[model samples]
Target: MFLKFLTFTIAIGGSALGGPIDPFGSSAARVLTQLPEKTWLESIAVRRNGDILATSLFYSSNIFTVTQPSVHAHNTAKILASVPEVNSLLGITEVPGSYDEEAFFFVGGNFTSLTTFSTTVGSFKGFKLTFPRNGNPTVQKVSDLAPFSSFPNSVTAIPQAPGSVLVADSFVGAIGRLDLLTGQYDPRAFAFDDMAVPKGAKLPIGISAMRMKGSYLYYGNPSTQSIYKVKVDSKGYLVKGAQPSLVANISSVAPGLDDFIFDPQGNILLATNSPENAIVHVDVRTGRSKRIIGGPTDPLMPDSTCLAFGRGILDTNTFYVSTGRNISDPTTSARIVAVDASLLNYY
Candidate 1:
């Protein structure tokens, strides 16, 4: 655990059980580094070795790894590898215990396939994963296990269950579980049909992001600005008839949802409201939300598109958030912002 910097003070808001933490004034929301120019950061992941991997999908695809200690003495980052000519790289995950028992990284996106990498070798140094084609949609193998079709926009590996992966088919507003060993894509692992999307909510054109905690899988619908929670079975499958519980409803605040992340404590949920161009923090249990950072108030806060937990030196909770003009803007300036996860102060 990274020790909290004494220079930083914690800002508590709401109530301990159902309130929010104010970390805006906390010194942790500092700019860590500006990625290389022309690199539109799309996805980010933190390796167990404390290295930060960021992927860009513009005209081509590239992955950069930031070494520990970050760019500043505050945190460290270094470019590990870059792959060109690959477009639409969207999601990333690290294979547990693959790199020196440190875990390798995996990336998924619009290439008609998926890819993984070993930690020590750098770049596209690992294995290339290919999915079998099933009709019009191209199927790709995840973790060399399950075969899945459709546009897999985001993916998350369940830490408690190895060889198990969760993918969000954003277009269908559905989440599926892939058993790497069996090569089966099971849509029944998620609870979605029960989620209520307003009277006429903009149905999910695609799923943008997903994360797993314990037996629960959290997903975001970018079109409707809603977050959903579903329970998975022992095999890491979504139990049937398990209605999706609403985590947050921000349709009125933002026309589109860009991304969301859970603090280390798993009690506070941070979301980037792209349409309104702001970041909101919500209590995990109560569903109440508060604007901790971002919005038009901060010129540096670009339209936040994606977020990941950044491991800071000395055991601090640092969250790395990616920002862009809009999902369609290929020329938008991209940046990674770091914030103290503990600032939210929830357990």
Candidate 2:
């Protein structure tokens, strides 16, 4: 386990020293909407009706909705609902078999500050939110992930495992299983040695982003600047004897990857946060990564955090990304930018 971590660290360190490569420049994307200055938009999930649901990273743990993402001029965001008592919100994903197709699960906790990574341990929780066509939306506490998880950052639904979703516990370097039906959680559902963070690290975040594709579960670790996947069973547990395989070490392309999404063709679009605010397009077959939009100093996408594909026919080819504060200039508004996926043809 130590050998694997050291090997990846060396590979990433070498590539990071080579500096970043930005091919698309700043014209490939445009800001769809933005929140007031100092508001940090952390995670984003698109609704079935084409609206974008975004979570606050440092704000009031409020969830906002940006309607008509494809039409920027007509775009405007309004506070949808705020999780009661929680100080910050992190990861959120839609639950497949819910009423009106508007049900979602999110993670939130009390954080002293994201800049300091000071989390109020044992305060993390998993919540379920839903919006009905004929009535108002509601937020409910689903599972308490404390006493085991230190920092739960991202969540993804298991299609084959109903009423269950996997949560990425970043600080603990583990993947947890949360049961929505029973409100029970197993913090070490899929812990691996490769997910460990080195001692006394500055930003000790592990398993930052997670997603499910087919029978495999893919996740990213910024501490290692790499992505990996493992096969899982119908029960949402990692298959016995299944080993995690490396998808890519993206350090050279961006400082570190925060979150990523996959297209139908199995290609990936990843977001880089903080110092290297950019988007990387990865070709899984060739293992090549290219910067598709933004850069370290691009104001349009000030701290790019997460990306999601737009729903429905009119905007299927569009990708909406959420941005936090401009680390270089905190006074700028956090934004949601739209980039045309067709730009991939030029690359």
Candidate 3:
């Protein structure tokens, strides 16, 4: 059975400049494109070359990429290569190399393994990556990678620090970092500690999505319906025994936040919750939030399962978001939409 919830859509009946022109505010968002039929679209990453990469658990084990024109418009996506027949492929990243080239890499949790694609080989069963695109991307097994049997939920490449990657180990309530060169876990990297909740209170939940800003690491808690920010050291390591501060409380809106992404300006944060099947935005500086998209308010919109920040081809102020047909759906039929970031100004 599909769980129903409330959502606030951009009120179109109001005056353009007087009333709420858009729920999000900036006039930067609009529905740009919809994904192909599938079931569970999980996480997305973009390459410096402007290629969009995405992974789907409900679909086959593969990495998909889409190329768009200089303008922010919808374009068809093509499957670059199928991930090895591993248990489950969860996240992908574009690692840059010398002379402005990049190597595409992906990590999976169920199998507790990391794999890199080769242009020469159709598929490489291990973690080693070889450059100089000859044929299909080549892959080799690397040593010293962190192994978490409980399963990792998400993997992200920090744009500010190239070669430094982070993985959210959901079951362990921790985030781990992998060194690109040695393919080994960096013990000095930052992560949350003292995460255990008080006797009567619930523990700080596992992180579903994370973004780095200056010396702080911002993360979303899917289980607790909260967003937190923690201070980190110079090496991008979390300060030892550091306690996370609540940036925004979402328990009132939804009990579970599936994912979240930051807007271009970094002033706004958008999140999607499963129970409510809605998207909400918050002002990072003030911790104030408002319903900007999804919910029972719009009959045409489906339950939102996941979301990410995408720039529209035409407008720099425009940001795009993608939603899965159902968080529980076993296939990849999902929708991608654009919304004006300026709408946040109304709130």
Candidate 4:
């Protein structure tokens, strides 16, 4: 096996198993690139070749790719696509092709717009994205936001469903399914949750990140800072209007939870905002959590916001995290970085 990096940090939080993790590895973490001009690196999608197609709030109509190390910024990452008439690209999930050809898609919202402030009632649109192997990427509108959808935040592609995707509405508190093959839309595939207005924020904050497990759909929200799972049908689709039940309560571990992915062993690999730069490993069966990477515990890296498991053959155990203080002010340390997660996977 091979490895690369900056620094690796791990701290078990809940379970009392397997001695403390080591933080002595050579830095396998590599910063994708620097953030300049407030470009909010929003979401990431791993290409088959291991490159990442990243979207943003500021560069709404553009999707950039983080490629090989280069002597200049333009060479390292340049415009991969210039989507037409799109605003604020965020949630992105790759839709498997029906035949030999595959396609990817993204969700667009008005979150970064000034006119949509204070209200959680805005709608979004979904697009079918094509990243040509020999050329740049392209975008095509596949479905408009369903009436029940309000600010779609996360889009996850369902492998079982041929070209099907589920989009999470952050404020409306629901998950909708879009059939890319037929342009069919189910506005309410599953009932995600929304919390009573937190003491500080407006509106009932709802689901943040979503991913599919074996016959179940798992997601996280502000409600008690817990992650919930719901049953899905044989086709890996959730019943419309069905509610998800709680699986793990990790409030004590990572209070400000964000996006997450599944590890090889079926563990929950998630990011947190309160700790700001942490990746927590949660045991759903035992309801335990361990901060595997980042925190005040690590002086080198700060808290991260977004999380995506690497999709390339060589990088399955790797994960990409977006580390920044906030949306508006991406710090010097603010960067889209990659981490070799083999330690956490097998630890």
Which prediction has the highest lDDT against the true structure?
2
lDDT of 3: 0.51
Q: Per-residue lDDT of 1-347 in model 1, one digit per residue for the tens?
A: 11111111111111111111122323647655554334556667775546566666543354555556254444323444333323445566654434224433344434432222111111111112211132211112233222333345567777767666676655445666666555455653453553223345444345567777778877776655667787876556667767678887765555556667777557544546354555677677777666666665464456666676756564346777765544445454455666766664333
Q: Residue 129 CA error for candidate 3 (Å)?
A: 8.4
Query: Each candidate: RMSD to true structure?
Result: 12.8, 10.3, 11.6, 10.6
RMSD (CA, Å), candidate 1 to true, equals 12.8
Ten residues in a row with the worst lDDT in model 4?
Answer: 1-10
Q: Quote the positional error of residue 340 for candidate 3 in Å.
A: 3.2
- lDDT string, candidate 2, 1-347, tens digits: 11110010111111111111232334556667657767888899998889888898866677888766665454556777766677899999998765654689999998887777888889988887867766667677777775856789999998877778889889889898888887788888989876767566567888899888877888988888888889987767888899999888887888868999997688788998878888888776667888777787676676789999999687798888998886546676676788878765635
lDDT of 4 by residue, 1-347 (tens): 11111121111121221121233322666554555545555677776656666676534445666653222222244556655455567678788764444578887755544223332344467877665555534467777667556667788988777667888877766778877766677867676434222355532467878888887888888545788888887566756666667878876876677778887788888877544457788888887887777775563345466777777666676787765444344343335666788655335
Candidate 2 at residue 338, lDDT?
80
Task: Sort by TM-score, best first.
Answer: 2, 4, 3, 1
Residue 198, candidate 4: Cα error in Å is: 7.4
Query: Candidate 2: lDDT of 119?
Result: 85
Stretches of candidate 3 off by over 4 Å are 1-37, 69-74, 93-99, 111-145, 158-161, 186-205, 296-308, 311-315, 327-332, 343-347
Work out how many backbone clashes candidate 4 has. Answer: 12
lDDT of 4: 0.64
Say which candidate scores most in TM-score.
2
